[model samples]
Target: MNRSLVRHWIALLLLPLLAACGTTPSSQHYLLTAPEAPLPQGMTPSIGVGPITVPEYLNRDSLVKRIDSNSLAISSTERWAEPLEDGILRVVALNLAGLLQTENVRLYPWHPKRAPDYGVKLRLVEMDSNAERVVLVAEWFVYRVADDSTVARRLSKQSRPLPATTQNGNEVAAAYSELLYALSQEVAASIAEAQGNPAAVSAPST
Candidate 1:
């Protein structure tokens, strides 16, 4: 091929490569955090948190924003450091351990010997963030593992205003963390109340 023709083809090939490189920005990955500090030591029951579920739309790695009641947008450059459900489960477990001040907390599917006294089952109905606020809706149950008897069941609908300083994915993640922390408080209280711990009966819920 002629030199000019070969150079023209090379330029055409490089054009797409350069354009692709310019359009694909580096993604920012964020993680959901648990409460900063554990609560005071107390006689909390052995608790299990999990078999938790989230919405199908939230199963992806990207962060989501609600455009309106019917519309949604998924970010290309903002993403979760891990799966959303995994993050939720991990943070809930940690928060419970902290709130209850006991080392007997376990995730779902523990060995028969290590089975917790109370099993916490949660299903997240909605988890979304927008310019104004973050919303989390969850249905949860606390049951006695030994007798397979239900202790507490509740559906929690919670919202927190997005930080006025910023409404990025990081801030949204922080809001999610706070919601999960509140949920842990309710779960811990249920377990404690069942175990006859007076202090936990008054623990707050979201």
Candidate 2:
């Protein structure tokens, strides 16, 4: 081969190697935690939940990082908290449906054949995570199906901090689980009160 041709081939071969020099692995995953316990008892009068309403800001790109406001700084691609919210809603529905009995509890997709006596609507006002703690705020309303009147309304808030020596997915999942559990209990308590079941009006914090 000619000398110049040999040198040109060597430079072409090295170009690809140089292009591959700077690369980094992504360090994030989409994870969510399940609820901790069963739903509250005595949720009679049959209730149906409407489509959950999330804050507009939560629907934007980078949902997880945007919701995890507690973090000092989060990568643009991190997606931890948004999935956590979805998990929480699913678990809450499952637990409540089981405890209240499927016949008496209805989730989304209200059926004409299985019309419930009351409808439940939830609005997530705030869900943010920080290094020290996570904060959640929500409002719930129970409407009487017959009259279409709001029979009960309540707002709940919770803040939980990370345990010492830990900052992993498991810890985050557990924290989210606890927060969901709390919200479910509050909703159940309000339902119980509306039903005039004083005994069911109080739910265990645990």
Candidate 3:
């Protein structure tokens, strides 16, 4: 090949390497956090939480933001530090541990012989966030482990305003954590009320 053609071929090979060397944004991972305030004094019952399920759209690693009613934007550079459902379970368990004042909180699928007194099953109907706000809708059920009888069932819907200009995933995660905390409080109250603890009925209102 001529010198010019050879040089052109060499340029083509180096183009990708040059582009790869350019500053590329790295992925940022975020995690949901639970509250750390001192728990109330009470002898909470053994509880199990889980089989937590998320929507198919939210089962991915990227952070999903709703652009409109029919549109969504999945970030390529912002991601969740762990599976969304797993993180929800972890945070909810922690929040329940605090709200219910119990150390016997366990995730789903525990040993059959060591079943908790009560079991919580959750299905996340919606968890969408945009610049304007973060919204969560969930359906949860409480049932007795020994008899498999229903104790309580409720649907929780909550939202928090997110600053219009905020694009950070950390804030979004924090808002989600808050929603989960509220849900946990409600679940704690359900368990308490089932045990005939009427004082805890309105204590978890937030």
Cα lDDT, all candidates: 0.85, 0.64, 0.87
- The count of residue-pair clashes in candidate 2 stands at 2
Off by over 4 Å in 2: 1-23, 26-31, 36-45, 60-86, 98-103, 201-206
Give the alpha carbon lDDT tens digit for every residue of 1-206 in model 3. Answer: 89999999999999999998686889999999987745645545888988999999999999999999999999999999999999999998878777777778878999999999999999999999987899999999999999999999999999999877766898998899989888888888888889898455323333
Ranking by TM-score: 1, 3, 2
lDDT per residue as tens, model 1, 1-206: 99999999999989988999898879999999985664546545788888999989999999999999999999999999999888998998878777777777889878898778889999999998988999999999999888889999999988899867778888898898888888888887787778787475333223
Q: What's the distance in Å from true for residue 36, model 3?
A: 0.5
TM-score of 3: 0.89
Q: Ten residues in a row with the worst lDDT in model 2?
A: 60-69
Worst 10 residues of 3 by lDDT: 197-206
Off by over 4 Å in 1: 1-4, 39-44, 201-206
RMSD of each predicted structure: 3.0, 4.8, 3.0
Can you give the TM-score per candidate against the true fold? 0.89, 0.70, 0.89
What C-alpha lDDT does candidate 1 achieve relative to the native structure?
A: 0.85
